[model samples]
Target: MQHNLGVIGLGHWFGWLEKGVGEKGSLKLVKAVGTKPFEDKAKLLTGFGITKDRYYISDPDGKIPEEFFEGLDLVHISDPNKFHKAQAIESLEYGKRVIVEKTLAINEREFEEMKSFLKKKGMEDRIYLHLHYLHKQPTLALAREMPGLVAKYGKITSIEANFFEPVNEEDPRRTWLLAPENGGIFMDWVHTSEIIFRMTKCSFGGIKKASDFGVNTDYDSVNPTGVETVVEVSGSSYENGALATMRMAKGTEKALANKTLRIVFKSGFSVFACFPGHEAEFNNAGARGTLKILDAKGKEISSESLSGQNSSEIFISEILDFCDGKRVGLNLDEITEIFKSQWEYQRTAGTRRLITDRESIDAFLRNGASYTYCK
Candidate 1:
């Protein structure tokens, strides 16, 4: 069955969805909404064989044309973070399945609003968060082997995950990243948070406390106030008392050798690393990466390297499942929990707060004033 897909944004990231949908052959890109001029839209849509009639220009008021939702089986939202909730809620209401870009909502309130809308319509399973990294070969391998490793070594005691990329002031994509409402590192780094949650199997013990530091600076006069260039977050997990730290930076002197995930158990440790060019390798055949395990004495116990595993396959598989009326991974509740924990982390930035009970977290989430941000 071919699912007719409509895209809400035509930015650079939309290319990934276009490529995947084209390759999968189970989905058709039929329509799109963008804020570009007609000539530009003609040029962009020509490549995809999408007619000008199917290409829509969004209004200044951010209203989607009624016609855009006419025949879409699914709508892929790659728009700005601020617009995600309304666009997604509208799509689901129109009876279209949704595939939203990462950081599903900018904050907990928006996430909760979307959750409430879905539950009211009983369409809770119709949306999927596009967390493609979790589908990578290295991550999958780690998830598969983690149980045995934990059984042998002991419980996880500490974790370190780093996702860093040099800021490109010249890139058009940098505009949204600089805005706090569109979400700086707080929204972007949710992928890492999801990875941590899945790695620990929702066993991070409920996030006991969190502290974050954001470095805002001007780069090439892009914006006078500048965007966050560096973000470092540290927190303690609830269950096993595991301490986790994640560092994400937009500006760095040198690119990182790899995006790394390291887990240290009570007795031994293991590390999984994925380099920048893995995606290209993944497309050609599969991405290559390393998984190394070491004993407490620092003696290497086992080391395995993987090659040629495409993570996009996971996205394709999930799309297929959605079309087939099957439930996909990363349900509403799970993603909401992730958003809640990350919000607490963001709210408590630059300070530490030990949340000893659920009541405090509930009270904080309930207070609308705490959710307000600079517009």
Candidate 2:
């Protein structure tokens, strides 16, 4: 497998990509790209000993950026929305593969353009890294296992989901997510709906009706259906001690959201998913999986799984798949399904505005919302 990689941005996300390479078991960061000044770039790579030779040539002219794709088989696009269009097409044009980060494009149009370009370039084989959820082993496992469970437990009855973020005023990306154009909460957090849609194996969990909760009013089209689920979201982060909640559902106490990840099952079971550190608030430091069930006396039965794998090292598993030229176990089709479901939900959802104050929020939770998307 090729160890070479080109980074299009040096912001927070690229740091995540690099941090994972060593643990990825089969990947090496041979090359990387960033627009930081020479001294700054040197400082950033000082520990890695990455030299000028490995530094990607800036696409000042957008002409393949000499040696940009030199030894690498994949280009990790971490650039802002405006650049994904050109960066993705150009990376494919150079015959290098692409591993685009979340919310791959600014909108449907840009995403479509990249898809069309891939078809034009005949580089579909080179595409990798869809939404993060599709890579979740348990979710995929559950999605696969749900049919049997439903066959035994019966069809899902009702679902209430929350997938919103509380953005910090000092942060750029969080603020960016507040806006509608760049996907904001609706687009970023829409994955919650997608995952439920996928797992239940119903198209939008029968999505019948919905109500708004905060400034997050992206939902407006949901209506009563036998198989649908309705959801709401609210958020803010105008101050520090800031936090966010990625997901919460019915019967769960409303807590100040801080990268919280939990799911409740009708099997009288509950699962909490802990992702690796991306921030002080969001980082669980390592992977920890917990299972909870109500005992006969109403006591809770619980178990947990800790990963020996590092967050970044996980990507190498997929790289090995590419090396073997087989699709293997990656969650490509699952994410595709989630994306489709999300498109439908967004087209037909509603929203509400919640009154927020620092005191009120801290009395429970600071503002925290996750941008995690569905397949």
TM-scores of all predicted structures: 0.82, 0.67
* Candidate 1 Cα errors over 4 Å, as ranges: 169-173, 205-239, 275-286, 297-301, 349-375
Model 2: per-residue Cα lDDT over 157-218, one tens digit each: 33333433333333333334334445434444545544554455443222334322333222
Model 2's TM-score against the true structure? 0.67
| Location of the lowest summed lDDT over 10 successive residues in candidate 1 | 366-375
Q: What is each predicted model's overall lDDT from 0 to 1?
A: 0.64, 0.47
Q: How many residue pairs clash in each candidate?
A: 5, 39
Q: What does each candidate score in C-alpha RMSD?
A: 9.0, 9.4
Which candidate leads in lDDT?
1
* Position 307, candidate 2: lDDT: 42
- Residue lDDT tens for model 1, 166-199: 4445433456654657765666566666777665
Instruction: Report the Cα lDDT for candidate 1.
Output: 0.64
